[model samples]
Target: MPEVLDARALNRATLARQLLLDRADLPVLDAVTHLCGLQAQEPQEPFVGLWSRLRAFDPAALSDLLTGRRVVRTHLMRRTVHLVTSDDLLAWRTRHDAMLRQRVLGVYRTELDGVDLGELAAAGRAVMADGEPRSMPELARAVAGRWPEPGVRALGEMLVAALIPMVQLPPRGVWRVKAGVRNVPVSSWLGREPDPPAPDGDPVGETLVRRYLAAYGPAATADLRAWSGLAGLPAAVAAIRDELVSFRDERGRELLDLPGAPRPDPDTPAPVRFLPAFDNAILGYHDRGRIIDDEHRGLSVAGERVVLVDGRVSATWTVRDGVVATTPLRKFTRAEEAAVAGEERKLTAFLSGGDDQPTA
Candidate 1:
């Protein structure tokens, strides 16, 4: 019989892995890599995401990393724009190519009828090859002569999102900067082609499984697929199952995790954490009962910025008139309220760059 781990147990382990338990002292780049990447569709969200997980995180450092090319914002993992390290982008992009294409097509298939994806990809790549950052509309219009039926949105969705590996250049994701997405090919931006898929074995897939568990584990396979947006990891999971240990959640779903990964005691103290909208800690799992209640699950996908009190979703937060305002989902204990208030003050300072005023 597999050992049974309850929700609180999973919550503690998850918090430990997510660097929310004790803020990580790692460099931003290393932290980004370790967590695989931060979901960055909302350009400014990753800054708050980092602020919550890192010790004394400097938003300027993140901006510098983006400008310095140490990190890139690109479409990956569930087909969302993610702020990932350059190496992770090159190493993982190829593995995600098919999934990316399928994801784009899932929405645009009818419009894309009669279009040759190979030709479209070539066209998109050629337009991007001129070393200019092109917006999605600009890229799509450039190729519209070749495939007008798909419309700019559908064509651009496929081209920039899937067919060509593209990245959102700096200023779009640079801290405190509000900018539109302008894209260049991943190869052109990074000065290297993506690592080709392994012909003989599934090394990358195995690595993804290992990395996923190290970061988000004691998780079910469904949770893995939900996080990765890749459907083809069963073989990868099987290929490395023996190297993993298994446990069962209270719901009796089998959870797989790396042997030495931390599974903190259920009673471990959790600090109040204010997560940015669409945070990975909440959205990364198919079953989020460990960290959020089922009734409140919609909040995660609905883009509600949540406050975690005692390691559970306790309230929703927003910046109201430069104040860090919170609305409780359930009444908070006095201690929890104080913890939340104290953290919000620090967060306001962080978000405002010590201005004592909240931004966003």
Candidate 2:
């Protein structure tokens, strides 16, 4: 019989892997890589995500990484913009190509019915070859004459998001800077194309499996698919099955993890941490019952910032008029309330660049 890991055990293990149980003394690049990239659609939210997981994390350093092209914001992993290492964007883009196309088609199939995708891709590349970044709308308009049948929105989404591997340029994802997205091919930005897909046994897929497990382990295959938005990893999982350790959740679902990955005790302490909207710790699972209650599960997809007390989502947080405030989902003990307030103070200080502020 597989050992059963109940909700609390699963929650602690997740927190440990996510670097929330203890803030890691790791560089920003290393932390970003380890987490397999932060979901960065909101742009500013990743700064808060990194802040909660890393000790002494300099928000400027992440901005530097973005501007320096060591890290990029691109569509990957669920067809969403993520702040991933340049190398990861290069290595993983091809693997995600099929999924990306399918997702776009899922949204715009009727609109693109007669469009020749290959021809469209070539047109996109040609327009982007000018060595300048263009927004999705701008690029779409440039090529709309060629395929006037499809609307610019459909054309641009397919071109920028699926047909061509592209990155959102700097000052857009830069810390505290608000800018509209301007995109160029991933090759134009990185100076190389995506790594060729492995002709053999899905080497990139295998690597994704390991990386996902290392960061989000003791997770079911369904959870893996949910996080990645890829439905083609069964072969990769089979290839790696012998190298993994398995346990069952209380719900009788099998969970797999890297053999040496951390699985902390359920009774282990979890600090009060405020998570940014769309954080992976909540969205990365098929079953989030480990860290968030079923009734409040809608909050994750709704993009609410949440406060975790004892490793569970216990409250929603927001800033209003330069003050941090939280609304509780459940009752808090006095100690828990104190801890949340203290953490919020630290967060406020971090957000405001250590400026002293009046208590909320």
- Clashing residue pairs in candidate 1 are none
Model 1 lowest lDDT segment of ten: 351-360
- The digit string of per-residue lDDT tens for model 1 on 41-137 reads 8899999988888887888889999998889999999999899999999999999999999999899889998898999988888888789999999
TM-score of 2: 0.98
- Model 2 agreement with the true structure over 1-360: per-residue lDDT tens digits: 989999999999999999999989889999999999999889999999998998888989999999899999999999999999999989999999999999999999999999999999998999988899999999999999989888999999999999999999989988889999999898888889999898888989899999999988899999999999999999999998999999999999999999999999899999988899999998899999999999999999998999999999999999977678999999999999999998888888888788532221
Clashes of each: 0, 0
TM-score each candidate. Answer: 0.98, 0.98
Residue pairs that clash (backbone atoms under 3 angstroms), model 2: none
Model 2 residue 336 lDDT score: 96
Off by over 4 Å in 1: 355-360
